[model samples]
Target: MVSWYDPLVLAQTGVRSIISATIGSQADRRLLDALAAPKVEPSDFSVDAAGRPREELWLDYVADMGDGWDSTYTIAQTVSRPTLTLKDETGTTHETRGGEVLVFGGDEVYPTASVGEYEERTVKPWTAAMRGQRPAPHLFAIPGNHDWYDGLVSFMRLFCQGRHPAGWETHQRRSYFAVKLPHGWWLIGTDMQLESDLDEPQVHYFQEIAKRMREEDRIILCLAEPAWLVAQVRAPKERSYLNNNLDFLEEQVFGKKVSVFLTGDIHHYRRHANAEGRQKIIAGGGGAFLHPTHVPRKESELAEGFTQRKTFPAAEESRRLCWRTLGFVGHNPKFGVLTGLLYLLLSWMQVADLREGGTVTWNLGRVLGAALVNPGVILLSALLVLGLIGFADARFGRGRWVAGVLHGCAHLAGALLAFWAAFAISGAVLPLGSVPQQLLGAVLVFAVGFLLGPTLMGLYLLLSLNGFGAHPNEAFSALAIPDWKNFLRLRIDKDGRLWLYPIGIRRVPRAWKPGETAREPEWVADDKDATPPELIEPPIVIGLLHPH
Candidate 1:
């Protein structure tokens, strides 16, 4: 698993994100998807039993996986099994088996999407879990932003081809696909690419699928991002384009047949439902860092009449976890090392003579004046201010610039104080030689920087998230909590009723041992350490069995 908090990892991801965004804007990849292969027919996905379309079907949905081995493998193992008997909050038992179709909603691999990453983080673990399983499930995936880092090359090669990633069969001809399910139900996965705009080819592709649908046919629309949740947070002018695209599809393509908006990318489980019985679910917790559920206000609706009904890690628990940011140094020592080095370099650049009449003297004014005059220090300072401003949340609008400036100034002030304190303390303790005092002061400065810099950064992130509703992704990714993971299981019964089971894993096992048999997951959670999965809520029944 990539340590997101590691300074080098953060730098690499940031660069990749910038590059991908730039490339996506200049060259649209979705337009090329049609040229890659012929559009798949909607009827291709109908589940068949005894050479006929079955009236009942079971399907599994997971996303934001391909991280740490233990967490990813744990989820893979659980979902790959033949049967899972779990209990709901009311103590009622529910038995479910692995889905005939496994849909990875988005972000199959983390850090960046590459062939190597997919093989190591996704394919290997899944292959291990599904080894020797019979009647392999059909697999489908939609590309999230991370997957588009490589322009969907790796994503297409892994999922779009009619090849098996593990024991599952991949039948989708393109990144986006339409699956015809039993009882006039359909599963449509749309690839929004980096930008949320759907290409003309994709629009026509779905429109073609729509022509075959009856007026009563309901859709389980799978998306990479939950545009509803995004729309709630961003301003109207800056609202998600994905939501707009869905609106177009609803208005022109499928009408009001979309019953469920299934998505991942948030790395947690949340459900919202409107009065019309339509559901919008975010179940990204396949296997990634846990994101906080408390960031979004309780009173806010995800969409028109769609109020949040369930969350896996309750808001209270999520709020409690925010305190973990205080231990930022322990969580990300490598990041701290970067900050420490930066502080030391800045301090060294501003080091004053501090020698007077055979005694080491501390002078803040002298150090500040020296730093102000130094061209290198001035340039570094400017870069620091600009970088911090750029790092501020864009959602904050102009306020982000103000916040970033203040934040940068605070760091500069803190660095100055640290330098002064280092010299003062060293001068007071060390003997009267200028060289010895300077050496000792430099050591103290580095020590203080290493310890205090990251702690301050953590506090800043925590305050930004809690106080200003900024840096939600950064704050939680820093924590890297592996618990509170979840996924979804959907079953369309013979009666045509759609049942959704949201399963939650409170804690993933930290230890693993090799399985002795081929039928078992190659790496099984140690029996003593295993935490069984349970339903986050009772099964959510969507749409009437027989609609008028």
Candidate 2:
């Protein structure tokens, strides 16, 4: 895990001063001037066959789009999602298709941002998917947090190269770029500072770009992170780094004019706007596991210029926040024991009466009540006991039951003492309430239940299952089905009007399975019987997306 950081960042502008003086302030005035020049000759990033730029440029895009574990569960949409030939809502069968220019918002590949990962996760899958195409769509991308995880070296090699891995020309010179489109439209994308601060180079680059563009020319801004997610869920008003960059771009650079704002990273589709018409459209469902679309419109904490227009697979008002946090915890059961142990460690130093509840002589009623619950707890204890038994039996003979019991008791005593000391210090000021105490105890119980392995967990899931999260079938105890996985097809027509098509997919395309090639699904151009594209209703208009 060698990283460029002096291991970690120094601060906002503290240690970053070195990077700012060196790389950020590199002498590139000649290149900047040339790029910013008006009426520049077209290079490889060309328009249609006629070489005459058309007024309308079609941008088909996806984001948060890479498989965590190969392609089966997460990357199916990435590999298999071709515009199926199907009957529209009117029942007339036709080829529903995608745009010509393919745009990737960010997080093109996942797990890590290494070059090898890009090759396996994005390049190979996309190249395979290119089998049915003639001239591939113009490919462009910006770096996400995952991409920056490896210091943008992989990002530059895969994306900033002259040609992409799939043999498509990537005309973007920098990780952050400005694409000159027809009809006075500009596609501006910037590399986010890994959700902290925009680097000085990026700001300087955009400033030069602003100096070059016409005052009236509009921009379709591509941002790396969706500030709304962090702004709403993680922090109230903090973690607005992305939005702060947006404001800087609009007010300081672009003079408070942005035609539209596009972002990814939430793994769901959301369209937000306000009365003034500025929109924030999140299309992170390129290939990652789905994020729940259950956040209520009213509960959304949008800025002055943004409000929720629609979220597909319409959902209900959210439940209590605590339950939601628990659901997130249960999504990956492998981590449940560690999380539960932490909770258990915090439980040792409760009020005296809470632990020793009975009088001097315990009633038979209380004893019976304790017995009923003790069996389950006793079974959980056996796991620890067996571990000690295994260790002692390996060293001593099977007859050494006394040694095993003593070892188990000794380990338990040490654990209890450590937990007691930790909890004593914390609970002095924590004031942990009754509900939190009960919730932690329940989590510990569930963790023990899961420790019985998948068979028992599966059986418990049937009786106590709530729904799934992270993936279509990954069980989460509190949160229900994660409903949204989608991509957007944005078009700017001859009339200079913007159009948005957010299409939802129920399942991902299967990938890297046995007989990997032959088992692959073909792109059907005339399958009207397949799952028809779930086109969200009330076709979105350009006015709804434009700058106020």
Q: What is the TM-score of candidate 2?
A: 0.62
TM-scores across all candidates? 0.94, 0.62
Worst 10 residues of 2 by lDDT: 1-10
Candidate 2 overall lDDT versus native: 0.54
Clash totals in order = 0, 4
For candidate 1, lDDT tens digit of each residue in 1-548?
A: 56897878888888999999899989887777688776548635455656687878999999999988877888887888888899999999999878989999999999899999999998998888776554678888898999999888898888876777786778787889898898889999998888778888898999999999998789999998888888767666547476688798888888999999999999999988877788889999988898888876744655578888889899888878888898989888888787777778888876544445655456788777767888877888889889989888876777988978887877777777788888888888776446788898888888877878888888888888777778888888888888888999999988889999999999999887888887767777775756799999999987564321
Q: RMSD to the native, candidate 1? A: 2.3
| Best model number under TM-score | 1
Per-residue lDDT of candidate 2, residues 1-548 (tens digit) = 01111113213223334443343335422234335443332222225577887767666767876554322133233323455443334555443455667778888876556777788777765666555543467778887766766556677777765765676667766777777666666778877645345666567777876776776666778888777655544343445665686677878888745767888877667788777666678877666655555542234456675667776545542222213433343444544454246325323222222345342212334323443355443454466668546534221234446555664655443333333333333344444434454444445434543333233223222222223211112222223232346777776777767666666665333323332343343332232322334655434555423543
Worst 10 residues of 1 by lDDT: 352-361
Score each candidate by Cα lDDT: 0.84, 0.54
Off by over 4 Å in 1: 43-50, 132-135, 235-240, 298-301, 352-360, 365-375, 395-398, 432-436, 527-530, 545-548
